[model samples]
Target: MSLQVRIMTPDRIFLNEEAEEIILPTNTGQMGVLKNHAPLITALDIGVMLIRSKNEWTPLALMGGFALVKQNQVTVLVNEAESAETIDPNEVENSFTIAKTKLEQAEGQKQKVEANFVFKRERARYQVIKQAKKM
Candidate 1:
């Protein structure tokens, strides 16, 4: 048996299919879900979500939201999502470098917070592409 996975954003449904395994980037940490997993809800973080189907892994950049796992069904609703296939690796790499520099140079608390968020987002996107290439 496989888990029904549906990932959605405000603009559209990003994915709707079956997955053998799912690795979610939750606020607490990474959570793995499989068939017959217990029902629960979790707040996601800006990170990479890895979905495995048919022995192949696909990575996606999730921009924070919520996820529900119930009866072998996983529903992910995120503020934004970017697929590895759609992202430009070169652009993401450059943005990630810039974000890291900005975060390091940030002065005030507010600047640090904003810069940190951008750094995380760009890092997530970069990781997704890297993971996809490996798999």
Candidate 2:
């Protein structure tokens, strides 16, 4: 049986459909979900979410957020989300470079922390786009 999966951001619903499986990027690490998986609520991280259906995988870039699983239903709510087709590799690479420079030039602890966060997010985006291009 397939699981009902729904993914949303503040502005829109990213996805809503039946999925054979889903791999979430959780704060702890990657978590795979299948039909009738145990119920849970977990914090997400800046990474790629892989959704599989009929042996085909779809990748989505996600910012920090949360996910809930209950009764074979999976719901992901994120600050931002983008499908593989919508990502621009050039933009991602440019952002990564900018964040990297900012992180290197950051002065104080607060600036460093903020720069690091942006760096991580841009790195995640770059990774996701790279993976998607290979598919």
lDDT leader: 1
Looking at model 1, the pairs that clash are none
Off by over 4 Å in 1: none
**Local error of candidate 2 at 77, Å?**
0.9
List candidate 2 stretches off by more than 4 Å: none
Cα TM-score of candidate 2: 0.92
C-alpha TM-score for every candidate: 0.98, 0.92
Candidate 2 overall Cα lDDT vs. reference? 0.90
> What's the alpha carbon RMSD for model 2?
1.3
Backbone clashes in each candidate structure, one number apiece?
0, 0
* Residue 7, model 1, lDDT: 97
lDDT of 2 by residue, 2-121 (tens): 899999999999899999999999989999999989999999999889989888888888898999999999999999988767778788899999999999999999999999989978
lDDT of 1: 0.96
RMSD, every candidate, angstroms:
0.6, 1.3
Residue pairs with backbone atoms closer than 3 Å in model 2 (clashes): none
